[model samples]
Target chain A: MNHSVVSMDATMIQTKGLTRHFTVKKETVEAVRGIDLHVRRGELVALLGPNGAGKSTTLRMLTTLLPPTSGTAEVAGHDVVREQAAVRHRIGYIGQGNGAGHTQRGRDELVIQGRCYGMGRKAARARADELISALGLETVADRTVSTLSGGQRRRLDIAMGLIHAPDLLFLDEPSTGLDPQNRANLQEQILNLHTEYGTTVVLTTHYLDEADSMAERVIVVDHGRVIADDSPTQLKRDHAGDRITLTAGHTDDARRVADRARRSAGAEVTQSGTSVEIRVLGAPQLLPGLLVDLANDGVTVTGAEVARPTMDDVFLNLTGRSLREGGAEPADAGADGGADGGARAAADADGRTTQNQEIAA
Target chain B: MSTTVAARETNTALTGTAGPNRRRPSLLHDTGTVFVRELLPVLRNPFSVVFTMVQPLVFLGLFGPLLSDFPGTGEGSALQWFVPGIVVMSCLFSGAFTGSNLLFELQTGSHERMLVTPLRRSALLIGRALKEIVPMVMQTVIIVAVCMPFGFELHLAGAALAVLILAVMAVGIGALSYSLALASKDQDWLFWTIQQTLLFPFLLLAGILLPLDNGPGWLRTLGDINPLTYVVDACRLLFNGEIAAAGVLQGAGAAAFLAALGLLVGIRSMRHST
Candidate 1:
């Protein structure tokens, strides 16, 4: 076990061309494409993708909930396929669905969860008390979980995952429906877990802000493949170019401003509202000339602002599609489809459109 | 290509080093975790406690008195015969209700959370089934207490032994029912309705209220073949101590077989659905 632990520290998680596919009604959908990954000890890694980007599938495969179609995923130095029990013991997972029994009090659930992990009743109870107090669940500790607010319940779910003090924790969209405050609280809890306990965390999220703030490293998955992997700042620096927005006088003048801006900046421009936004690698050098060029050509600019790009921009650069546009047409195309399927498709489309629109923009 | 590299880098940065090689959990541990999580809701909810107690009481009271005036009211008082049957019925009814919790958990995302845990596969079934057993046993006790004055005598000294046997049967059946609920996650109403409809038919057909000899030939044969009939008969014989050693053994065997079958189906169904 110590030897395994040494190797585990060397590579807490390692995957080679890991892939997962599903056949739904005879249509084979590749949810996780071939990819290689190596996770190190005590890191908080965020799996970021749009709805169908396969973030959950990746988590599922790594967690042993779903087997990989090809390649291999090893967790804590054990193969997810063959040594699933080993993998399972070392990791704690809090999936998108919350997975709580509402009728139970928050603290009681944690105690039982600990006991299930082989802790004695006394030990489990002590741990439960510690977590409930640590997570600020004291007020709701004895309340039936069903009576808890959404955010409180999610917090309890996190507490439950940590009851066994697993070395690796998997959180799938942990803050999906949480309020801003709850989301912040959860982010703090995650950071605390990593810092204080040296627990490794692998989480998936659609919230770019959450990903940027919470995750030390971000993995942007698109169409079942790794689209971008880097520190948030590095990713923004690499793919999220400088953004220049020119608010036009009117909608009628939007396209003309966009075309001129596009040519002058040697970048792509898109019209949103009365603004023609241009994204270029070097916005400062290009901006002055573009402003002058527009002024000389009698194009009136109401305002201009240059800002650093975001994860959404990084996504656009990688997949050529904008995340926001995926649902511009239908709000519920994926509703009633299982949670995984809907999420997978959304993430995939986010990746594809980010690339396509990166070129078009 | 650059995008993929960046994404790969990000993936590694976040999840790479934190998973699999660590100390994983065991089956016994995981099952216990799941069971404790499930038990809370059943124990705390007012409705659950009421339903568990009231349903059995209702069956014992309504059926016992109605049959008392009937021409064929046999040896003991109607309440005496009906009490044990309802006690068995409580276990069966509550066992089937286990599915509701699974269905709700799936809908609310709790099921998915549990799936990701290293908790043992058997834990889910065991935890849920056990959670249900306490209430079921309580319901049986209440029914027995209520029927004491009505001429139904349940040997209290032997209550623990009887409850233990009944509990094993209940847990097995509960697991089967829970698995069925998971398989039909979104179609709970349909599944539950089907379960309810199947209940009385199986109950009546199994000879719960009357002896197998009293029913029509086809009915008697159906009772002989019905699993419910076996369970009721087994519980009755054990409670009445009418069966000699062979009869007790046969009843125990039948209960065990059905319980095993139920557990197998339930676990298998859960694995497939999850």
Candidate 2:
């Protein structure tokens, strides 16, 4: 039904004020307060947020896994609630939990998923074979999913989602539990798949590099609302900007350079000891002029380095909290609390948070 | 790592549109697939099958001999009279408790995975319920064959009807059990507390340990309202060669009612469940 709509580069996902709130033990935790997001066809968008950011809740509502408390989402040109089957048929979702049966062999699980999507057995088998080889899952395809390592199983979960070759693929933190090497490998495979199939791929992750490297457009969600949405480069340029660092012979020279840099370039400049850090919007071309002006101003520049801002810098510029801190939580902090509770209940329901954090900012 | 190779293959082989199963959605096919997946694990673990059978067999071995000397066991032996109750009890335990596996499924994320699929929620419940039927039938048949040496004379057609009754009972119980499991998704204690509380009362009221007909008036009246009492009665009538009797029909009717009710509850719960 979606394919019948003849427009090229059609809008793949459209949500308007989609919100969900849960009453966990008499406390109403607003997981996703309200979020409006749009993704055109063939775009790889990453929902970048921390643990309680409500990125997972957005994906869940978009994928038709959970109903939004208010507002609406149209995924793959079908209303997530009214035409759920249509949406479900057109999209492949691989949730954060990997969404796989433990005892089933990875290949068989893939085949069943293919069948669920309405693929003929022969076609399902062929696609399963191709995906197994392409994803480097040939080694683990025949093994029981429970026996496979987490990385291997996650890859298999990817293969399962890819079985039907859906128009849109939703991955909720695909690389969360993966090691660095495997994360990179999976990222490569995902990018390759998107490029090959031209599927609208939306993933959520708190991993700075994964989002920075994998997604072309990063939709930064916090506390159930979109904080910033743009290409990684553009977001960096708009929010954090490029930083030019100049090391002077003395702290007096550093301060003089910082003052001149601030006045002449109209940039945000700060000096620490003998180093002056200037955050300027168009750093590359502005640097040469600023250096020449600094020389003209009689400030000796000992060393200079231009560092492009990272996603974390962009996040810091947007929200005060750090993403790395969410990852470095104590091992037992969320161990037994996996069952439904305040923050986690919303987490499980595809919820969001940090709206107050955003509002306060 | 080889992006070019994958991209080249994708250009040549992959299509622009995805949305399989869009043309035809068959309930039987979907249910069949789930049934196979559900049963395969049980088949692999022989220990589970043996463990389930132990309870019913224990009822037959320990209770059957004790009742032989006691009065009120009509024409045939006490083992023959007691076998149907044991069969239904076994079916009740094995079938109604299939939800325990669902607890594991939910924990493992498999249940959530299934829900995201295009498979109908009703089909999901039915498929899981169907998994209990074949095993319950097989277990009941084995119990009947075991009772043959203890003066148990089973009418061929009646024996077949007894299997049907057990299967129907299992479907009803299995569907209801799954509903409860889905409602109490991750809360093992909530499900178990309700399950244990309801189960023994049904067993005791159905008079699985003794015939309630000879019991006090109040107990017999309580047994009359319990659906399992009718099922056990139907199985008894079937075992004693009353396949066409009104009591047999009533028993089957009670089971059918439970099955239909369980299915309704199961489907409704599944629609709202995780």
Candidate 3:
């Protein structure tokens, strides 16, 4: 009811060369190298990275939790450095861990959060009641925070942040420790929050599918800088294409099928025995044609399945390394690199894929 | 804690509507809210309430009476002189230990959560400082009340001054302790080391246990330097309603100065903290 509509393209966050360096053990660790990023109003952006990536650091800087060692970032239309109070007023932040007092009841915590944002007693009470019901926390609202389960505690944390009804919310690894069922439940709740309030959400997650499913735009961060930023579909399309596999009744038939698929523009086909693997951009549309030609050529197409790429594939294709390995493989080259010139060449290929995505956008 | 996602159907009114300007929570209100939150644990937990009150009570019951007959205790009488010291001791101990709550908050990530809010940084520290004051006053009252049953004479204005001095001492020490916690959020050992070590010097030099009248020259010199000495001296005189006494006035001045110092350190540490 108190919503104030903002322009569609108005910037919600803008950063120029935002960087942070940490001195650990008397040695400099460039946690966040230079990374320039922008997010428009109402966009749900995910900062996806492996464990050591600076995604959390970037979120901390934007939320006014940590000061950027260098560069500038303006969040929610307020400069993070000089105008933290102003930025804090318009946004809610839920960190990776629980943020409420241990023994306090969930309702009391929410009410206190509301009061901290300057709400009057009756109004804060009403708001706490509204939040308890909105987040489906009525069951746990009366329980002490220490007694609630992880998922319930996470929801209560979100309730605390939302008590003031911020326009923009920052969540750091929101679903990291939850079971699959609880993780899915929390995602649904977050989505509901975004849809109902029209809030601009910025969350960080390492899970491939979580980012792909929840974020409208995913910012792939590695080594403290933004390596790629685009929609999940666009990222997969440009970095890794669809995989189409076809099997025939005979090795000769498979060879024939591969020969024909190879003739199609940009179709990379490999033949072995009775099976043929085809990598192409538009697999669904070409699948029918490929099957027909093979049938007309006396090759019985016994099996066919097309698979799509995931965020992991995008990471592998971009860094020539796997995020599952903690992104520790040097970008330039290794066993995981290029798919050939080692790791370094593979890393370059990943960089090119990111450039292509930027160009396409 | 069991993982209980209640079967209550998924639609309700928990979604909030308060906006940035829907209400500007006043600074005073925010501080009060945080203060109340800090006070709840103390009241709810029997162990905490008992522990906070027991030490001073023991000192007053066992230590004060034992020292009432010690030699060279001066003309003020042992109980008369010792009560003021105990009062100051209560403030220092309660206020300083109150910071352990801050240390707990830091460990639990609640401190960081509070930082991200619109609540003022100063308010967070001030709220906790204010919470410490309540117990400090309560314990001081109990200490004073116990001394009354011991034939200890009372000066109405002096007793009031003593209570006020206790609060000032608490605020100052609590602020300093909180600052130390903020500086190193997780190194609780460091806080304990300082708490266990630095406090004895202040307590002993302030002459809480016995009169320092005939102590070595160095001990008396240190007492003169410690703010507690003036406070203890003033509290002793004020309890007799010696309002015009210079020592009473000096103790008030010292208490005010220490409160200001503690607050300065507290606010500076908090403002500059992450």
Candidate 4:
């Protein structure tokens, strides 16, 4: 299929220069700056960023929970600013917190929420049962949400958001607190939801692996603006630095071979205790040659491995700061006092990298 | 929690998932949804039910008899003179309790979820207000039952029905109080500050537990203008079966004024919240 042709007919969400800002204590913070984005129907777009990168704020605006400071956005063909009600009708937003009430039983709460959205009592009850089974919540459906584990509570939150069957879904940090297994389960569920319901999903996360494994497109934001948008493979080939870590049988042997390896590979090599680290571009393909040379020189190599670049590398390349370093630039980047400036920038940059990776692939 | 596509597909088939054929939910429908949800939590909370009913009964027990001997407390017994007060006060307190839940929901992000739903925004406040009203009425019934032991007689000649009507009006005022509190975003401290500043003049002017007739001329006029004073006056007449024509006018006016005020505030706040 022609990609642009399909995309033109499948625009489930589009935003142009969408902006939001807030002024606290006489200091203006621009959370979301001028930016353009598009998500096709049934597409799972991962928005990756560090904390305070305007991810939550962007979701809030898209879901109609917060008004945009300035800009135009349309979700499901409804204007976010002029037709907020219409936008709301088509989207389900699962916020950052565990949204389910701890005091109420999961089933009871779901039924009540369904009714609040105008479902008949009998219909709501039936929907509750179905969701409970679907989300694997049957065992604890009748129990208070407070008793559910972190993963279960998170699933319940997703269930509550989905009860209304909105066409577009927004999940902000859905797996932030989940264990690895639970996070994987959530990723599968999100993928299945997209296939089954044809729902367009936009989720924000701090985990690059999660973004790589799930999102069809990735958007990275930093300093309140988009820096990269691409697919995983293209980003890895284009912006990621090559990684080479070697462990030798002896520390002295590793040190003796490190300078020669750097001279041969023409890369920056550093030592960490018994292991040597080599960071280079296109170095993975050169590992065999390097290993052969090491053997000829009579240096015993216990272990050697080469790794391609990651979102972490892409992040460091663009922002000169690791994702763990709070992903923020200077405060001046958020001069408009928008809560989502940072998040939106991170999401946009991630998207760009993911797009680049896909192109390269 | 692991999820499967088959399960979601089955549920979608059963519930009629959103599509081109789906009808956009109307405002009335959305409000009804919010109203039902709000009532469910309140009805299920035993603590709220017990507190609402028991607190007023205690007041009737401790003070009703003592006030019977006081001049100008026209009634069959001490408890009878205070039955109407118990009903109004109980409804007001219950309404305040309901307001606290709304605040809690907002702070906890429950309200934020609702805002993103297809439901009408007004449903948030209106539904909550109605929830508070139902329990307030139920508490009024329980307190009236307890009042009967202390010679709390009701004029069986249709006059008892008048007191019930007063209870409804009091509930409306209470709803207004809760809606206002929610508008402040659970900033109960700010509410308390305002409450403290307005306390004395409001109490003296409204004459909630006392008669406006006992105040100075200007103060009496102020009390007459106060909605609660009129509510108190009407309760006295209706409970005693001394339903004078003027009593009906005074009570009806107060109730109408309160109902209108509450509705206005609730609607306006819900409309512009986000």
Candidate 5:
């Protein structure tokens, strides 16, 4: 057996041109298209994408749950395909659905998960107990998993994934079905664990706020390819600009403001009736100056507000479609339709949109 | 939130391996772990154990008296010939349907959780199949005990050998069921269709409920090709205290072949399940 040493700052995940295709009905559907990723240890990254954008497929490949149709991936310093057992030992995975048997108790599931990782019986018991308390599952730990509420079950799932204290962890849509309160609670628990253990976490989520609030880095995916990768702050600044909307007393004034706003460098100006909206990189600083310029031009500004850019705005700027729409590009949708007679692609997009609405609600 | 305490404890528990030298348990250890997990649900609900025996008991009670006076049942008592056949029948019904639990696991993603662990791939199938032995033994004991009052004598040594043969057959059937479940994926209809479709043919051809000698030549020929027929014949011979019968060796050979083929296909499917 060959043993490869891993340094503290070593890359936890590395993939080059990683791709996967699925044959839905004799016609191939390219789920992931040539994804290249490099994640260092201790980095909390979120793969931000709508449903069917292949985020889960990518996570599956990284966790060795699904073999990539083509390309290479090394997770935890072992090839995902060639050294699956080695990769499995070094990482933990919490898939999209509940991972515990319905009839088993949460505590028993945790212990069994530990035992699967080769822990001794005594050690497994001790670890299960510790996780039961740490994840606030002490009360529900003895009950059958099916009896637990969604929040409790999701927490138990997290505890199961962390039983062996893996150096790297993968979560697929961790908060998709969760209500706002439970989603916030789960996010806090995940963040706390990541911060305390310095465990590298790569979670996939279509919840824009989740990726913006919890992850240090967000990788935006669209049409099975990465469109942008940066911190939430940087992505907002680069892809989307803050908006400054001003309403004048008359249409002539709004038109004059739009004309002047266009003269400013890199500011996009649009006018509708008596309102002029200006999109600029720095709306806060530019708002005050623009107000003074309008005052000097003898144009009375009745209303003025600066709105900060959101993750949705960033996605819209990059893809020309709202993330909430479950944007499967028209061209890609047509291609999928042409290949499989349109029903599958249409239903898939509709299903994703419904799920996105649930998360949004 | 106790996060710090949990984190510190986890570090100690995992034993910071600086390299790929993490300690993995042997195959036997992993199989034992999986076996315990699979058995816990059955142990918790003891009623299920008896519930599964209801059908076999029904067959024995309603059908055994009718076979008592039938001609050409060989030299042994009809109960002796019928009891072993019921035991084999119980193994068939229970073992062949064990895959339903696996299918449920696949749908719930519990099996996927096990897959991501360091447990050997073969251990997953082996441990699950091994769990079938416990209930199988219990049912066999109950059937024999129920018939003892009806003048069915117990040959302890021969019955033990008969149980060993049934256990082997059970493992093979369980593995094959699990493989079918995997092949069917999450399609509940496909799993049931295949299991139900093949089960009746196997049962009828094996002639567990009747002797094949009185049947048409084509039926007898079909029974000759049925592996379960040999297994049932072996069980009857063993239960009759004929430990050295030629049928005993042939039944064991058929059982060994089934076990080997089942494991080969099962492990292949498990490895390629992703």
Candidate 6:
């Protein structure tokens, strides 16, 4: 066996220029472009992107499920390609689909998974019992996997991945097909497991709220490229901002207020009829002072509202497209934003008109 | 309190013995684990085993009496000559279709889960192939017993050797089936089309229905090329109380060769499947 020196640093996962490509209908599709990522030990990170954004592809490469087309990745301090077995032994991965066999009992599947990782028969049984109870799967663990509900099956998948208690865990869209209640329950279980075991957890999800509420660090990917990487709060603060909309007595007063907002550095001002919208960072502190100044200027302000940014806003500001709108165009069309400009502009206009109408109503 | 004990036990079970640096289990140990896992479903649902034997039993009842008056079958009850060929046929049909299970697993993502473990790649294929033996043995026993009351002589030692040869052949066919499944992962039609296309030719050329001795010279040449012919001939001889015959050695050699070749291709495909 070939042995390479394992990195002694606290880094749990590191990838440099890692890439993957596929051939579909004789055309080469680059699923994952050059991506450099580092995940420290015990950190919870989420790869946030829409469909076809290469988030799952990047996680697949790190988990040693798919070989990188170029560049290198080291997972759990072992080279993903050269020391694959060592890396596999040290990490657990739950892919997008359910991983347990349909005919086997959930408990039996967990035990066999433990055995695959070289646990003794008695020890594997003990661990299976532990996970069965710990994941609240005792009721369903004895039933066939296919008989369990989606949430139960997903939890069993998690238990299968954790049978060996690997130091690092990778989850690919773990909550894609579940209802909101089940999705929240699964998230709580994942968070609890992460806290108790101190496992380095990396998961990919398109659910903005899931990532926003769960992961400490969120990496935004689109069209096979990493567009932004930061803490969720920092990302919202940097890429998106609060929207402060004011309705005035007349169109002239709205126009005057827009001019004043334009004077504030980096505030994006849009005026329509008697309403003015100001997009700026820190609306909570700036809105009150702007209202008092307007009072002093004798401009009757009829309405005022401030809306904070969501993760969807962070993604929209980075890509000029909403993550809630499902599909992401390929790199050729999306790179220049030429083909998708009209649709994106219409969506933005519709959003603003709807917000203004709601304020009027 | 019990939850805490379970948690502590989990910690020790993970860190104390099953660490990353722990030595990997032997290939045989991993194969046994896979074999047991594969066998559990079959054991739980025994109806499938009986269902698989339905076609062989139908062939025996409808086709055996017609073979009695056929030429070149030699001087013996037709059941003796036909039962061994039926065993071979049953093995062929059952073993060649085993890949569909793997195809289902691949679709469900269970196979991908197994690949991420530290288990040896060869063990996955080998253990699956070995699992075909249990049902093959059971079908053979039932086929032999069903023919006994109809004047079929029971040659214990020769029949045992015949079972061994059939088991080897079944392993070979099962391995090839799994390799085909892996090759045609998303396109299930390819696996079925190939399996169905090749199945009858191998069966007819091997003379499992009627002796190929009276056929045309070109047919004899085709039979010589088809490896199943030797296995069928060898099994027929062994079941007829002629365990010392030279055809038995050639059949064993052919079966072993197929097993080795199937395993080689199967293991390679399993390793590179993703």
lDDT of 2 by residue, A263-298 (tens): 755588889999988898878888898789889989
Candidate 2: chain B TM-score against the reference chain B: 0.89
**Interface RMSD for candidate 4 relative to the native interface:** 9.3
lDDT tens per residue, model 1, A1-361 = 1335534255788999998766543445677889799899878899987777788778878988777779998898789989776776777888777656777677777776666556667777777776666666779989877788898788788777877677788998899888777777677767766875577899998888888888889998877788788899899888878888888798766666887876763587889878888878788888898888878877888889998788887877776667656421233435544455554574343322222222223
Interface RMSD of 3: 8.3
State the local distance difference test value for candidate 2. 0.78
lDDT of 5 by residue, A231-276 (tens): 9999999999999999999999999999888988899999999999
TM-score of 1: 0.81
TM-score on alpha carbons, each prediction: 0.81, 0.87, 0.86, 0.84, 0.91, 0.89
Error of 4 at A102 (Å): 4.7
- Per-residue lDDT, model 4, residue A333, is 45
Residue B237 in candidate 5 has what lDDT?
85
After the best TM-score superposition of candidate 5, give how far the Cα of residue A247 lies from its true spot, in angstroms: 2.7
Better candidate number, 1 or 5, judged by DockQ = 5
lDDT of 4 by residue, A1-361 (tens): 1122224567888899988665433335566776688888888888887776767767777887667779988887778878887777567788776666656678888887776556677877777777777777889988877789988888788888877776678998888889898887788777877876667889999898888888888898755567788886677656776888888888887996696677864587898767998887778677888888888888888888888787888887777678765546543445543444444444433432222222223
Return whichever of 4 and 6 wins on lDDT: 6
lDDT of 2 by residue, B165-198 (tens): 7788788999999988876665678789999999
Q: lDDT tens digits, residues B1-274, model 4?
A: 2235534543454223422213567767766677767665555564658765666667666656567566655535756666776676666556555555656666666777777776776667666665665776577667767767656676764345565556456546655765655555636665455544544455446554555666679888877677766776677677677666587678778877876788677777666554
Under CAPRI classification, how is model 2 graded? acceptable
List, for all models, the DockQ compared with the true complex.
Answer: 0.29, 0.34, 0.35, 0.34, 0.35, 0.29
Docking class of 3: acceptable
Docking model 1 quality class: acceptable
Model 5 chain B, poorest ten-residue lDDT window? B12-21
Instruction: Pick the TM-score winner.
Output: 5
lDDT of 5 by residue, B1-274 (tens): 3445544444443323222227778999889988999888888776687877777888898987788768757655789778888999899899888999898888777998898998898999999988999889988898898899988888889899989988888889999999998877757788899999999899878988888889999999999999999999999889888898999999998888788888888888787665
The list of candidate 3 runs beyond 4 A from truth reads A1-9, A244-265, A269-278, A282-306, A329-361, B1-15, B20-26, B43-47, B58-65, B72-78, B145-156
- State how far residue B195 of model 2 sits from its true place (Å): 1.4
Sort by TM-score, top down from the best: 5, 6, 2, 3, 4, 1
